[model samples]
Target: MSTLHLQQLPLPDAEVYFIPHFIPAPESDVYFGRLVQEVNWQQESIKLFGRQLPMPRLTAWYGDKSYTYSGLENKPQPWLPVLQELREKVEQASGQKYNSVLLNLYRTGQDSMGWHADDELELGQQPSIASLSFGGERRFAFKHRTRKDLKPAPLILSHGSLLLMQGPTQHHWLHHVPKTARAVQPRINLTFRYVRG
Candidate 1:
């Protein structure tokens, strides 16, 4: 395995690292296929404005502890073999030990995530999150939490790419994957994080 080179993002009050091609093409293809078949994906509903609406994408949670966010409590599923393997690699690359992972599947161009920070109380302060992407390329954007003058920075998260968000990133910024009008294939994202005991 080649050493992953990290590129630091130029942003105030944030510590973010971008590593493109964290996994090789052949391995990434295999991992994507296996995970698609093995993961028990579900469409979850979110409560918005007194209405329950299904999320735009499929999701699964795996870890040793439960997590709660946005009025949803996610019970951890036992780690799958393939997920454990990938987690080990991610830990080695990010130098962070994570006990849980959240997987999101974007099936097409319309599937998206709204701007939000991963600053849940269960994640503790200054959490480190390692996000790995596979299958299709999508735009990942970040905007300052309070500064309206700062322009949102957009990044193309390609297949086999890895992005690490740490330090004060979550406290100062919010990120999201926006929907696009262009045709797109399925994309899978795995975000590894630690849950405070």
Candidate 2:
């Protein structure tokens, strides 16, 4: 286990904590390999503009209850052992208990998430989301919700890193992993959240 260090990122109207190397390299490798094989990764399609289209990345949901987003309802898959283990670590680090997690697998540089906030009604008014990254490094950017003058700040989400977003972060900012042209390896991201019943 590595010494936990929280690095605060300066963003307007948001509270974010970046922890580089949250999991050691050896442990990260094990988790990454197991997750790739154990997780039920699926490329789900969503209804957009009255047309169905595949999501850019593969995703899986695991938790105590179902979650709905982007007009799609995600039935909870029972948590795997490895996921449960990681969840405990994340909860300890962030000091927040999460009952659900949304896992995203970016198979290549072309796979990405669009700009959006995790502000669904099920997440309550303010939610604390703990995102853990493994495998390849990717660019994570944040744009101010109402401020057009503010430039988007890009952060490098390296393997074995953990980012904790809390407070008014989701309410005032939109974040995403943009598509890239450069060659990149697969990456897995797990975002732990506490969904309201």
Candidate 3:
């Protein structure tokens, strides 16, 4: 078995664990491949202080209903069949029902996400975030807020996998997708969340 295959073997969950080609072989490519073409990706600009700065990456959101977004107002896209199937699978595993998912498409190695917790009001207190990844691999880093010197570890999220961040992860730690020099392919991430009405 390959190293990646070995890593996929059930293990105790780390702060992060590599799912390693977690998607079933038959349907993996089709689901995400279609998603790549279907999502209406947009580069959004955020007002920082007095200046409007374009975010480093492109993003989109999908769900059962309309959602209020910061900087951009979005209307819900009708749920696709593949997404509905995936949602059911994720719900079975995580035991959480997510009404919406926020997608981030990293177009190049230069695109990245900044450090922040997912502690938004819509998520409710201590909400569980079930993040599904596909396409090129990227390094996801997490660091404890109070331990400056602690070595932040990297988790290479592979195609067709899920990572669950639960409990106080949002309250105590910050996570980010750092820029890389590696020649990376496009990646799509679906962070399934339950937004409170």
Winning model by TM-score: 1
Better of 1 and 3 by TM-score: 1
Better of 2 and 3 by lDDT: 2
lDDT per residue (tens digit) for residues 6-34 in model 2: 88899989999999889999999999999
Model 3: per-residue Cα lDDT over 1-197, one tens digit each: 11233233122222333455657745767877888888788888887788999988888877975556555665777677767888887787676789988889898999999887777776877878888888888898776777666666567787887787776677767789999998998888888888777
Compared with the true structure, model 1 gives a TM-score of 0.98
The lDDT for every candidate, in the order shown, is: 0.94, 0.95, 0.75
By TM-score: ranked, best first = 1, 2, 3
- Kindly list the per-residue Cα lDDT of model 1 for residues 1-197, writing each as its tens digit: 22678998998999999988999989999999999999999999999999999999999999999998778899999999999999999999888899999999999999999999999998999999999999999999999999998999999999999999999999999999999999988999999999997
Cα TM-score of candidate 2: 0.97
Query: What is the lDDT for 81 in model 2?
Result: 96
Off by over 4 Å in 3: 1-18, 65-74
